[model samples]
Target: MVLNKIEQLLEKYENAETTLQEEQELKTYFSQDQIAPHLEVYRPLFAYYKASKHETFTKDIPLKTKNTNVYKWLTVAAVGVLMLGFYFNTSKHITTTDDDLGTIQDPELAYNEVVNTLELISKTLNKGTATVGYLQTYNQGIATVNYIHELEHTSNIIFKNNK
Candidate 1:
């Protein structure tokens, strides 16, 4: 009767359905001497569990963290560089006079300048429109492909109906 119950518990244990109490019963059964011949294979497994249960870590673990001294020195060096750059930047004299600012006093020269600027803007717009002309050709090619697909679909329907 005990052997039958042990077999049933072993089946459940193999399927991972055994409870903690059922597992303990199996462990105790396997730990005994003079078990059935076929059941002798599981003895070493239970013995291993029993031996491992008494094992412990003997060495001390170190909890030391990494040093950030290099990172701190890098941050200090970066701040020093920024301070030196600011010192040099502020020392330079940058005077912005009217002529340097490109302010025109003569009306005829100003009108001519406006016409030249408009001409440059128009040329840039014409270049953009030339690229758009390629897009228009691409759209026509896509429309042609779509028409070919419609013809193929109609031919397939007509041939399928004739068959």
Candidate 2:
């Protein structure tokens, strides 16, 4: 009879469906030495619950006051400093003359300036390419001269071997 009741309470406990009274009953049952072999496994768990249930809060917590003069002043000062920094940053950009930012207002002039700059760059590149071409011709001439020198040197060795 007690085992049937214990089984029902154990089922309810695992499902978290037990009320405080039902939990207390289970805790009481486990606290006793007459626990069945299968139910012994749950004994320590209920014993811990029974032990923790007797504990009470010893200290009182203090609530906050409505007045916050110093704290409020500090918060306002922080916001003011942030606003001043933002204003200075933006104002520095705004105060500069149109000459500093330059001629986005004239599209044709910008286009002509870009074309002129590109032409100058390509002219310089062409001059460099022409110089590299002359170097390549000079390198080919030097290679041919070296090949002839090797052939003559080989022929001189053959002649000396014959003599």
**Candidate maximizing lDDT:** 2
> How badly does each model clash, as a count of residue pairs?
0, 0
> Candidate 2 on 1-163: residue-level lDDT in tens?
9999999999999999999999889988998989899988998898888788799999987788778899999999999999999999999889997677665668898999999999999999999998788888899999999999999999999999999
**What are the TM-scores, per candidate, against the unseen true structure?**
0.42, 0.47
Question: Which run of 10 residues does model 1 get worst, by summed lDDT?
Answer: 92-101
For model 1, the superposed segments whose C-alpha errors exceed 4 Å read: 68-163
CA RMSD for every model? 10.3, 15.1
C-alpha positional error of residue 146 in candidate 1 after TM-score superposition, expressed in Å? 60
Please give the distance, in angstroms, between residue 130's alpha carbon in candidate 1 and its true position after superposition.
Answer: 46
Give the whole-model CA lDDT for all candidates, comma-separated. 0.89, 0.91
